[model samples]
Target: MEFRLIDRIRERTVLARGDVRLGIGDDAALLVPPAGQELAVAIDTLVEGVHFPHGTPPRDIGWKGLAVNLSDLAAMGATPAWALLALTLPRANAACVDGLADGFAQLAQEHAVALVGGDTTRGPFCLSIVVHGFVPPGQALTRAGARAGDAVFVTGTLGGAAGGLRLVQGRLPFDPADEAHRALRARLDRPTPRVRAGLALRGHASACIDVSDGLLADLGHLCAASGVGAQIDPNALPVPSALRGVFGSAAARELALSGGDDYELCFTVPPADVGAMQAALAAVDGKATRIGTIVEGQGVRALGNEPLAAARGGWDHFGL
Candidate 1:
């Protein structure tokens, strides 16, 4: 059967707000802030099982929901300003909901993001967040502007999250006393988004996208959208020091390139601005390493020039 449920929903539910210059279409929903201001927007969702395991920490769930939305705004090179939250719970537990709200409030306070409004409803456990921010006009980094010959770069190390997941599931043999294991486990619980580095790369980056869908998959997104391809050097991926001991070199490399939920920034910059970009990243105590180069093609290639396979076919709403 052929169905257009999504299209129907878009047609019916798309509300036209005065501030929304464009919505429900295009690469992103666009809004025009007051004159001399900028526009920033982000979307994130938390599902029952996919985002959080059963009986997961409520505080962490709250923190992660806000964090992921902020990560999206960060990817657009915007300074987060406001947020709207929506929640659907099968049965509301006052304590659990309060703890979640506390987590959200704390992070919002730290980032100076105001929670202006929200809605609550009854359904399966799910939470959605939309954050807004601002940047200089014509300065937002996007996935559509990358050009061939641009250098690809990623911030911080990778693979820690995947390693952490393994530890949580008891899938990896590890000593409880090992500091490495402890660190990787923490990474899975809390991920730091590269908001500062993304803002710094604004003018320098020809195209940008957060590493939410693994390095290779996200880079492929940049390529497909920009009409370009990339050659990623396997050796160039920065795997966290702690993860190396637990997973070894080959496994670490795979995780770094294919693992999702890193929440880091992967962007392309012009060769000449490399120094400035590096300098800017340094302010945030973040490191940027060039891992590949953009070329005229349609997908991403890994080392030895082989096409990189999608890890779990990227993050999908339904299932992999």
Candidate 2:
């Protein structure tokens, strides 16, 4: 049954790459990195009822399982090349396998990422995915390069995923026929990884990190790594209109500050390079908004906003 499930995945995701000398059929994958390039690899594990809610569809789970890993590679300004998936299921179910494979393949194809090797087992539902990417030497972005005078920016809007989770948990009122509500739900189900924006920022950004654990929390990580601090202007955050409309400005502001799973890129660039960085992202059909500045300190601070308390609180897996 496990072999059959693997066969289904292989059939659903058919991709060809010269670097992938040997793919899914073997016990190990053979890949060759291009010359003058550095390899960037990232892995993420998603467990049922932890990373996602109970009763979530297999397709959405597959997409998110891969999406999260891709976001990690993007944070380093890498171009995705291959993936290996280890999926666990409660039982052998062909329909569930097909749905998961289809969703995973859809995003893999978009990024030209080939599924090289993986494993399957009968256990509590979970997916562990490893992604490999490549970046030019000395061009990869890292969290430790931010300078005290750098400008802090974020790609795309925030809080939609938190809003979607609220709607899913029945904590927020929503109408099935409303497009705004549906959009929020979509944000939670299928997040767009900021690969292009990361690429655009490679030569320009001094530091970069993906907003998986909310902006404030992730920014705190970047600041800590760079030996710097940040001052965020609450009014400058890019809050989605849908979230503000449904949750009101105050609640939406709080959500934008600390909502997790948004999958957007938060980066820091020199003040003089901000214009060039924005133009580069714009050329890639991406948008970046400046919300703060790097400063000399130890952690993140909100500027004259009562929401500093909320900014300090974000998703912590172990409640640490």
> Highest lDDT, which number?
2
Residue ranges of candidate 2 with Cα displaced over 4 Å: 305-307, 310-316
lDDT of 1 at 3: 18
lDDT of 1 by residue, 262-287 (tens): 88888999888888888888877878
Cα error, candidate 1, residue 221 (Å)? 0.5
lDDT of each: 0.76, 0.88
Task: Tell me which residue pairs clash in candidate 1.
Answer: none
Worst 10 residues of 1 by lDDT: 1-10
Worst 10 residues of 2 by lDDT: 305-314
Error of 2 at 255 (Å): 0.7
- For residues 195-241, could you state the per-residue lDDT of candidate 2 as single tens digits? 88889998999999999888888898999999998999978999889
Instruction: List TM-scores for all candidates, in order.
Output: 0.85, 0.96
